[model samples]
Target: MKILHVVDMISQQRGGGSAKVPYQLGEAQARLGHKVTIYASDFHAEDQLPPKGVELKKFHCALNLLGGVRITPSMVFADFSQFDIVHLHNYRTLVNIIAANKGRPYIVQALGSCLPINGLTIPLHNFIWRNLILKRASALIAIAEMEIGQYVAEGADSKRISLIPAGIKCNEFNRRPARVKDGKKRVLFLGRFHEDKSPVLLAKAIKILNRNDVILLMAGYDDGCEKTMRRQIKELGIEDKVDYIGARYGKDKADTYAMADIYIMPSRREVFGLTLLEALACGTPVIATDRCGVASLLPPECGLVVPFDEYALAKAINEALDKDIASSYREYRIKWAKQYDWSKIAPKIIEVYRKVLGT
Candidate 1:
């Protein structure tokens, strides 16, 4: 099969998980002897090297209309008809709009953006999605069970929606990291320092916890909230308790997760907690909010699911380090992570593709 994967950008720092899903999935699919090409904007083209088998087609994005809705004017004239199947990595983007307008059947994996958020674009996005994208989509993929409802709310057909979790590269995290023993135990946060991710919430929670033994290692690319988070950190006087590392990727990301005593997903809303799985796979203690879609997939003995309250988050963090609430979870971390590896998960996606193609 000839597969075309579409995304807004092609780098981890620029596109986060959105860029990764396609590259990984396409690579895995290519290994199965299928031709895969990924279509994306040239956000950070020079830095990215897509995995061996996947072909990356990058078009120049001339304008950014805030919140990742960029205008790649050239993509308007580009062709997508040659592929046997098309996969869209995000919702409400020029790429998706073009795929819909092209009158070709495409599968949509919203990558957790199905919820009607992202201000100003909501109404317009709704109108376009409901009227066009949703109607034209052959299938809708849910990374978690909760995302199925999000697809329904977005006007996607229920029968067309399939639950498909994102795949992980297990081998990259196979090396166990030796933690540098300081006096303090560290809890790591790996994501963009954006308001949506609730960087300030974690800072406030760290302040509320007021612990001498635990340190919050905040690492990520800043998405405009670092200044505010830094201000609040200073105001709360928890500067010494928190360390701001820019971002971690490749082996560094694996090492960061492995070295941590605990990992946290403090996002106000996370449809699929990729970092949560990474941390769990690394055998790190973990905490997530109730709103995390991936939380449902984890067993009770694996992680703490608290509400979004700073106090509650702080309490969970305390329990994760002190009580060791996840003993059984640690025992099965590596084995469990292998279940969602691309090698296993990609075959299920191929089944979906086969069904869609009626072959």
Candidate 2:
């Protein structure tokens, strides 16, 4: 099978997870003896090319000022008929509009953008997705079942939707021995710092818990919410308690995972918290909000789920650090993480490809 993978920008600049998915899938599909070509933007440097049987096609795109996501121009839309199947990953910008207008049968791997509450750009995005993209899709792949509801609400055809969770390369984030807290436990928040991500709320919750023995390690780039979060941290007098580690990727990201005692994500909205899966696979117990799509897949014993409230989040955090909580649940999370590796995910994705391509 010859497959063309499309997206807005396929660089590390957009962060790791989305970029990693296509690269990993391309590699796997190529290994299984299929041809794969990735279409990405030059603005986002290529992290890794498709494997032996795959190809890379780079195009130029115009950058959207506010979101920083790129738009694919009409010129890039030519030559859509070359591939057996066109698979799109996170190509929700004008790039998707171009692809849809090309009038080719395509599969949309909708990551999370279709959710209304996830962005303020909903009105315009709705127009683009409804009028331009979803209607043209042969299949709309959702990361999780919980994530499919939003698409359904948007009037997407039920039969066209398929739920497939994002795959984690387990070996990269192999299970580590549970860290026993000595003095201060290291808590990691790995994702862009934004209101939706709720880093400020996490800081406040930690302060309310008054767990001086726990040091909050905030990782990832500040996505326009640094000043607001910094102010909140300062007001709560948690300036000393919180350490911002900025953005990390590659082995640095894995090492950051290795150093943490627990993973905390207090995000208010999540289609599928890919970081949640990454942390669990690293053998770190997770504490997250009810809204996380991955939360349902969490082994009941691996972590605790709470409401998005500060108090509930704080309680879950405190519990996650408890010796009893860690001891009783550690193995369960490790076992659960082992089940959804990239190796397992690869074949499933191929099956979807075959289905969409009618092969």
Candidate 3:
């Protein structure tokens, strides 16, 4: 099957699930003997290398509009019908709206963007796309069971929505043996340094913990909140405990995860915590907010699911790094993450596409 994946951008450093999901899914789909082509903006395109068996078509961003929507006028002239089916990632984008009306049976994996977010330009974007895209979509990919109602509320038929979780390549992360490392208990927060990801909250949690031995390895691309987080870290007098390591990829990311005693994701709202899987795949114990879709899948033996609160996150971090559970979690998490491997999840996605095409 020939598949077209339409996404806002293919830049992994953009530090959003939508940015990474399309390429990773496309890579996996291509690996399964399907031809996959990706259409996205050239934003940080150099930072990403498309996986083998995938073709990437990058269009120049003609206009950066309200809400950072990269308007690619070239999409208007591009051929979207050549593919057997199309998959749209990240809702509320101008390119997605254009591609949705291109007469191809395209499914939407909104990546939690379908939730009624009343952002600056979301209403206008939704108003333009509601009929052309969501209503006319072949299927809606819901990453979390919690997102089913969100799609239904957006005037989608529940039957047209398929619950599919994002997958990780277990081989991408090098699994470290469960051994005791002599160093400060490193707690990693390795995603967007943005408010939605709650990096500031994690900083506060670190401040609240007031621990001398534990260090916060705050890493990733700055999504407009690094200054605020850095200031807060300084204001809270925890600068010595927090290290700001900018953007890690490939081997660096896997080693970063493996080096940490605990990985914490304190997202206020999340569809699926992909980093949780990445961290777990590296045999790193994780703590994510209950809002994450992956939080439910993690057992107490390997991970901890906490609420979006500093005290709760602080406690979870402490418990995750505890001597008794930490060693055991490191050993068990690698086994736990193997179940959601992309090799297994890609076939389920192909099933959705085949069903849409009546194959």
The sequence of per-residue lDDT tens digits that candidate 1 reaches over residues 191-307 is 988888998888888888888997889999878888888898999999999898879988888899888877888888888888887887777767888888888777766678889
Model 1 CA deviation exceeding 4 Å by range = 117-126, 324-329
**In candidate 2, residue 313 scores what lDDT?**
82
- Residue-wise C-alpha lDDT for candidate 3, range 1-359, written one tens digit per residue: 99999987888767367877887888899889999999888866755677689999888877776667788888888898789999999777888988898888999998888767666977675667787789899999898888888888888999999998888889988557443466678888998878888898898899888888898998898777888888888898999998888888888889888888888889998888889999999988888898887898888877788888999998877766666455775667888888888888899999999999999
lDDT of 1: 0.83
Highest lDDT model number: 3
Q: Candidate 2: which stretches are off by over 4 Å?
A: 46-53, 74-78, 117-128, 175-182, 327-331
How does candidate 3 score on lDDT? 0.84
Candidate 3 Cα deviation (angstroms), residue 103:
1.0
lDDT accuracy of residue 40 in candidate 3: 88
Query: CA lDDT of each candidate?
Result: 0.83, 0.76, 0.84
Worst 10 residues of 3 by lDDT: 174-183
Model 3 CA deviation exceeding 4 Å by range: 46-48, 119-126, 177-183
TM per candidate: 0.95, 0.90, 0.94
